[model samples]
Target: MKKKVFCVLIYLQFCFIFPKTSFPGFRAWLSPYRMALGGSGYLSFSPLTNRNNPASLKSKKTFYSGLIRYPSSIMGQGLAITLPKKERVVGLAVQHLSYGTFDGYDSESISTEKYSSSDTWINFYSSKRSTWDDLKYGFAISWFKSSLAQNQINAIVFSLGLQLYLKSIDANLGISLNNHGKVFSNSSNSSGEMPKETVISSSKKLKYLPMKIFFDGIFNSRYKLDNINFGGEAKINNDLEFVWGTSLNKISQNTRQSFWKSFFAASGIGLAYNINSIKIFYSSFFLGTGTLYNGVSFEINVI
Candidate 1:
């Protein structure tokens, strides 16, 4: 079966990716939904949500989303395809962030073209509904690769997530355990364990208002209290929405920084259009300064 083959692939990855050491500031890539919602994605409706909470793969459609950074070469793209039974989903996602190319010199102070320092992630996800309470269970395997000069570092991480929806309260809760694995290096002297983290998030739809509020709390084993983010989305109509939120994670003590920088307030607007069985969405967010992160996605409800 396809599931058996995928399981074998995951087993092979664990064998090659788990030999262990320690490093801080591991790759914390964010999806567009996370960026637009000020870093809250545990209960987002985008295809990329699988990266944040695999239990969010409850969609019964063929979904795709892609994001590109402004004035940069960074990109994140993902796709989700639902099974015929409509109770399970499988997905794949890829993200690449480049820190630009640098000059390679032989200690002669002479330019030798440019080599890029980049990080990439290739992830696979699957989720299914449990027999009780309609709850969802999800799993993900991530392949992390970092390229710096001639050295390439690779690692694999496993994640488990669960999602529950309370219709009486109009609220959804998602919990995830992430980054469980070890690192491997092609060069000598640099192999370590990845930073493990726990994420808890919830979203509540207000009864009186056309809005939904989201909250997320993350705990890192190596770096306690990593961040707390919350935001709200106000629906103006069935197709247009406004979003705003702030991140309290990386605030600075400097008083001279812009207010946006001081609190990391990220705001954005989104529009969606539905045509028969297909729906398209577009969204963009402020990333401080003049840079903006943009995202677009489409979904097809298959018959």
Candidate 2:
């Protein structure tokens, strides 16, 4: 157990100390559960969390999930399906983001036709337990595409992840390297780079309370810590749970506001309900600019 822990720590240190060039796209949160957790879900077991950590694909049953975000000009949706095969699990997911139509203008400011822009991702992933039952490892390959009017770009990304289950502490620790790959563009206006991130996360179920807590750190290039998020899920009943989360970046951005307002800025709250083999989730997020967006998603278990 100690050796496993050490290995995870070493890997995290290496990733942080040796940063790589990172671009600026493909970092959007694809899962409602993750967004509701203030962008922290690297240690979660839900199939929707597969984009954050492929090692979370360890499950005995198959799962299918769909998500939609709205109330904003920029809309997004995602779909994920996971299948268990013998001792390993394989999954596929797709996420799409659409920017509202924009009016086109020429160099002389003449009005032209309206155009829309969008980004899409398709991911294939797999995971399995290591020699030790407590350790899990996984990898993922993603194809990404972005379009803006007549310009288009494509990229392929690769990710690797590791998760360790500490039975004694009833906690899970995970590390992941995501979006590490090259990009190609059909237009000269596009940059041939994609964003990369390193994440460290932990989740623990309280022994004395019917709750679980999560903490996650995200790092970008130049060894800079991009964000730190904290989230909690409390069981309200056998079939329902309350979820809430906040991030340091949000709080920092609203320091001039009221204490509570600043604290809740960029925060999120939601509820999850379970009925038979289906689970439903609803979430609302408070943007730093005071705008609010709601998301809904559902998952079904297929034996």
**TM-scores for every predicted model:** 0.77, 0.86
| TM-score of structure candidate 2 | 0.86
Model 1 whole-model lDDT (C-alpha atoms): 0.63
Q: How would you encode candidate 2's per-residue C-alpha lDDT over 196-272 as one tens digit per residue?
A: 77888899999999999999898874447878888998899989988888887675457455666666787888899
Deviation (Å) of 109 in candidate 1: 1.0
lDDT score for residue 111 of model 2: 89
Error of 1 at 233 (Å): 2.8
TM-score, prediction 1: 0.77
Error of 1 at 51 (Å): 4.9
On TM-score, the candidate that comes out on top is 2
Which pairs in model 1 have colliding backbones?
21-192
